[model samples]
Target: MNLPKKAEDAHAALAAAFNTGDVNTVMSMYDVSGFIVPEPGKPVSGAEKFEEAIKGILSIKGKMEIKTVYCLQTGDIAVGRSEWSITDGDEVKVSAKGIEVMIQQNDGSWKILIDHAFGAEASLVA
Candidate 1:
């Protein structure tokens, strides 16, 4: 799916930032009002809180893969469904299905207004 221009850039930037494990660059991609649903932790808002959260995730040296879904836009809001696999080296730390609701800022930058992620694991059933 083809994402809108800025959204596409944001998606790439987010992936690069994740790979770099740079909290600031990652945060730069988000709006001031953006938020994140952290795994194994609490939700984060604003820069300071977000930074702390990223630091923790970065500490694990995680990477994310998100496929840009050609979702429509309404005003400044856009909807997306992303399938993500996060890894700390060779170990799959978090496998997830996430929905990101994004909004464009005044500067034409897109940020995550809401993020909800689910954990994926192989269940042992006998």
Candidate 2:
């Protein structure tokens, strides 16, 4: 799959990838050095780590829905705020807000740099 050119496109692509239950496709949106805070204080980095973190979600067998609340871009960097949910049929299994930083690569495609999946909830708990 091709990388997303814009923030909204990234979210759409992510949702599509998640629905397929393909971990490799989901990880394609992240940069090689990208990291995600899978929980309150623990941050997982690199492709291998990310794959491990994402496996649990895939096991649930659901489709993802994401809405980009806002995105601000400057030069090659962009910050985005979004709300996302994983649903089984009409029932939501998990929902959360996220804040992420994306970097525009040389090819002008956006790849996630830092993904704080829990958003403010993580800090509140810390």
Candidate 3:
């Protein structure tokens, strides 16, 4: 299906918010009952809870860059993959892969059902 622009925009905004370390913005991307798969170091479930879980990483000096937004919609359910990288100052902290599952609400807005982030490994920049 050709997913609506609003849905695509929302996902894009989510990526921006997440990369910028904006707690409120990031939290805004989820539904009340929405869930997250939790990167290896993060906790699962609840928007605020997941926000708190990522604080540690956000605390460390870094900038997040997201790439490859792959989305597919089946009825009202949408799933996407977000590939990301973290740069700590001039060094690359990590390069990760993530996936999101979203549900379209009756209001025609979208909410995330799952947000999972993880990496294959951590490598130091040469």
Candidate whose lDDT is highest: 2
Candidate 2 regions exceeding 4 Å error are: 122-126
lDDT scores of the candidates, listed in order: 0.64, 0.81, 0.65
**Residue 50, model 3, lDDT:** 72
lDDT by residue (32-124, candidate 2, tens digit) is: 597887665778997789888778767877788888888899999988888888888999988888888889989989888888877755444
Off by over 4 Å in 1: 1-4, 88-90, 119-126
lDDT of 3 by residue, 1-126 (tens): 122245555556665666777666667677747656555654377656777755655665677776646778888888777777778777988667776678887778777777666522344121
What's the count of clashing pairs in each model shown?
A: 0, 0, 0
TM-scores, in order shown? 0.74, 0.89, 0.71
Please give, for residues 7-37, the per-residue lDDT of candidate 1 as tens digits.
5455555666677666667676666576777
Return the TM-score for candidate 1, rounded to 2 decimals. 0.74
Root-mean-square deviation (CA) per prediction: 5.3, 1.7, 5.9
Candidate with the larger TM-score of 1 and 2: 2
